[model samples]
Target: MSSAIDSKHDATHVDHAADPEKIHEQRGHQPGIFTDKDLMTNAFEAENREHEMTLWAAVKDHPMACFWAFVFCFTIVMESFDMFLNGNFVALTAFKERYGVPVAGGSKAIPTKWQSALFQSGQCGAFVGVFLAGPITNRLGYRWTTLLGLVLMNATIFISFFAQSLKVLVIGQAFEGVPWGLFIANSPAYASEVVPLVLRGACTATLQMSWSIGGIIVAAATYGYNKRTDEWAWRGPLALQWVFPLPLMVLIFFAPESPWWLVRRGRTEQALRSIKRLGRRSGNQASAEDTLAMIERTVKIETQTGGEPTLLDLVKGTDLRRTIITCLMYASQNFAGNLIANQATFFFEQAGMSTDFSFKLNLINSCLQLVANVLAWPLSGWFGRRTIFLGGLVVNITLLFILGICASITQSTATNYAQACLGVIISFVFAGTLGPISYSIIAETSSIRLRALSTGVGRAAYYVAEIPMIYLASQMLNPFGWNMAGKCGYVWGGTAVVCFVSAYFGLPELKDRSYRELDILFHRKVSARKFKSTVIDVAENE
Candidate 1:
């Protein structure tokens, strides 16, 4: 094992002109006279090398890490599936017959007030759940916290499956949301921790892919059952929620706990074992040791600068800046016209599309979202997070404005179709960029000590923004309400413009940087725009 560095050493700036080879040659001549700085420098070099590794190489070296990340994040699929079902159930004929009231044309539709309540119920529960996830994960670690959520999800499904009243259904959705919050909050943090730096962006981004998968399943299931007049048309999809948690609970039990969490708890031996398990396919004990060393050093440095890990630290000093960045980064997703995608089926139905056509378009839209999410993996590697996210927002803003313009034209088949097509394009761009890159930003931005909590707070902010937006979208799309239909684009496009401006100024480029490097940058209070260019010498910093 390599010698450990003293945790209390004050960090200094590195001279960029110094050659690494010459420093190593000097160390080679020194032989047995190794210092703490030398050991720290070696750990940093190893981590940097790992960062410089290609995506394919990282996957080959850490296949188990990738597999486990997928397994844990798969919990998100269930969360998104149920959330979609909650929104789309209003579009189901049988669901409306069961729970809706008579409208002007003798057609039954869920009242706009009820629609807003149902959507906000889940967000309310998720807000509580995400805040709860922080302390629970801090105490029990990621594996057990996720296990508890999965178990609770099984019990919550019964509430939705047997719901006979609109109130009961709302309660069920809210109950189900608790576990969903736990899953969403934990997945990205777990993925970021278990994978190497090269895999971090791609792995964390998979959470969105999981979300898209769930949406696709819901779209297909709801499409298949859209014409059914029986209660099973709605109940069957609610019952499908049971299919995910049991299998995930089993798989997650055997998954390795995040070594970063283990290190934070001061369980170094367990952290080392976890790291070795994650990298077992590589068959390199030395590499495992080095990885553990890097995690410890990063954690220790954070501790030195930030002191004891507490939720309050999230709002103190430089951490406050980080907290705001994470909160707004997540909050921006909700503002970037995502509500249009979330309530697509209902929006299409109200926008003059037939029931059959609405379901079909939503299914196709779901499939496109899944494809866009998959494309995000390579795009993240190629163009980086900030560029893609900002670029995506630009496209979404333009599409939304065009959608509003289409709505202003004489209502016709062509104009309605144009608006629907525009919505689909916006969903594709969003799923590809803002949706996936936000996960990477949240994972990379927070300090390791506060990752789970920061993520919880960030995700909680998402629901905070989402709850109100869902209500507004319900009001905008409901025929009995505002009836803005496609014109709602102007409202959301304006918000997207706000998101783009904030991201332009606040979002930093984190591609190819290690967590340890990130800690140094954050601790130094580097400006957001300067993160990519700032250089640190790990030995001098230590």
Candidate 2:
């Protein structure tokens, strides 16, 4: 069945590669040195290399790949602040109370409850945006889709500066969500496709590292403006996001398009041009040929596997069931209490800490996360995704346990400081492994057909879980106070168990496979946990 699908898709795609002019006309580029065959060869070579070598080399050699990886990492960091903002500072709450337009109930005013809804609405929009990627960007090309997303996100930030009402503010936020989905959906495949197969993991890790940078950006921005009374103080930090995207947009405009998307869309000539430029080889026809051949094989396999699976299929099919497990693995990270740790300021103050202390502590955690992210790149290579994700989950479970203890500490005896230090340590553990590595795994776990959809589903689940947590967070703190620590502790503990089980039974090893080869694995009826072992056994005996 898989073979049949591969052949049908391959035949359709190969026909386009045979006639390069058709692709050239579509992309509006003149005849180039490389041909579609050369692209095919390059892809094949990359895929055939051992997984560990390919993942790391991609990071070290390919500038274009690294650049996009950086953009994705930073984008996540920036967007994550929205999650922590209201949760972190009392000053922000003050701003809402002071400037907020009154509505029906004072507590449930336009800006009060509406602000919470805006966050949820943005998440909902993100779900829609993520779903949009498979069809729109899949047809349009990754480069174009990414650039469009970047523009919208930056525009959203710029417009947000002027938002007078909560409704207008959220509408701006919704636009930002779409671009985020595009980047998340496409960049993983994009980064993996461009590098030497040996260095793919490192390159992807570098992309994941951007989130730490984003964490720093949000933390620093929050800390810097924590006490400012000026109208533009908070707005200034928001406006700075505009600066990050403009230069990135220009770079992306000139950046090479995703070779896989190009090949899939039957634009083989452009695919050849892109691969050659990325490989830094001139007139190396073999590379282009390899790229085309691999893509041909992948497309054929996709066709045989059956049509793109729907959301319902996610719960029903073998490949898709694996995809769901992968999504759940990542979702576990979000719901695992890691985010609440980052947003600890809100809870800390509720426990009687001063506003100044909360900001300082949040900044400290961000710095710790930065150190951990840097450490993850080398650690991921040494440990691989499976080990790191599992280890992180275990450590997170322990930290949550400790946090519960610290939360019980009283302020009179300086025990609260100990609690703060423990929180920072937990942040370090999260940043080092699951934090950066999870996204890389998500990007690689599924085939192109369901990659975006799976990520959307996973992230949407993450946010959906967040909505309830956010709503009840303050209320929960009011009564249980220190006892509330166990709520997140339980969630993280459960998450750890799920991850362990998945690693033992459901998760696949995507450490070093090329996008095309990975596609073949998805078409089969193998168990996810067994895939790595299955692939390795076949490799070793051969």
Candidate 3:
């Protein structure tokens, strides 16, 4: 069955880019295979003027899908919260004394290699955890896999709170990262599976809002607690990490597993139930059965064409191209010169802003980021992903280059203040554009079976670029060290230029395509330029 389906698909498939006249001739009439209106989810979404209303309709229509999306998105929030907490804590007087060696008359402190790397241990753990997400999710399924990760996460945070020694604390932070890494890498793939295609981008990008929310919460808490040199300043936030996952664990226990995963496992009935629940029509599995059968069909066809999904597939042929784009997609998030977004508080302080003022500024920046993420929801429909992704990159390339030059002239306190404001503005534009969209891009780039695996590879947290970037970023910003302050943007500016060139030639407009259509496009090996105009009859083999 599978071999026949693949053979038939290869025979009938057409590349509109290659033979435009033929596709142009057939543009008016509906193809025989794509008869079902619901299956063309992206068409309904794009043709309608009210995509914003469509987003609400999707949530109202599938409240459980919304629930699972929100739950999955919090793992993203956990990642954001942990990142900000680590970034902010490094600037704290209490945390520094506890974890660092004294330098300049004991009035200020700088972290040793051990302390510097300890903050990064979570990223290291995240790399390992993301790599493990594929097998863990494959064996245990989404719910248990997520629950187990959360359990480990909760335990590690507890360990961080009670630690009396630096060894204990660093070890705990590293271990704590493992589970949330597992959680984040798996969460986006889960949301992509459960949500209808119409709402996939919005659901996946909701992570940015949750991420901003967590950062705001951390900034506020860290500001309040860091007044005196006490353990509560850091420990309070450490303990607060548990607040997100505990309730999430309860919620996942009640949520159905991903229907796509169920289909691949040959549990079609369970898959139907899952789809019905997500579709908000549990009493009527008619539509649910259709979607489940579609998944099963795709799996069967793919099994014949290739084999069971593997990480190795990500580095071969068409999959390798996707893996590169996704890897660079994730890299683009960091390398696109938003270092200010990562270390906003430090940048503020290094610019002569007082600690309280820095925290206040950080709070405002985070609020802007949250609002921007929310605004991005509507814009994600109004503009193609390639447009926003490149727009942000182009703007940042210019901003980072200018900002780096400004860093070189930081002799003037006034100049530092002005650039600090500029950095905030740059961050806002970034959040409003590429920051939220990257999660969706990476998840949507791969086929269903490899979604989790590809996302894992894309999110391999502790990569080579980061080691030098972190070390140099630390050296440049440390008050007692090189203190390049705002000038560090020069380094990131170069990387942003590289990212921009690759994205210009390679990034496709994947804004409003159904998963099946996307798979077909990749299967044909269409160039990025053809994506917006390409026509795919996803139901051909069905």
Per-residue CA lDDT of candidate 1, range 123-238, in tens?
78889999999999999999999999999999998997898888898899899889888998999999999988778888988988888899999999999998899999999898
- Predictions in order: lDDT: 0.84, 0.60, 0.74
lDDT comparing candidate 2 with the true structure:
0.60
Which runs of model 3 end up more than 4 angstroms from their true locations? 1-53, 100-106, 112-115, 281-284, 461-464
Query: Tens-digit lDDT track for model 2 on 25-120?
Result: 455534443245454344335344323233444444456556654654455554566545534333354454545554443531123355455556
Best by lDDT: 1
**Deviation in Å, model 3, residue 302 alpha carbon:** 2.1
Q: How much is the lDDT of residue 195 in candidate 1? A: 89
The model with the greatest TM-score is: 1
Candidate 1 wrong stretches, greater than 4 Å: 1-42, 280-282
Candidate 1 accuracy as lDDT: 0.84
The total of clashing pairs for model 1 equals 1
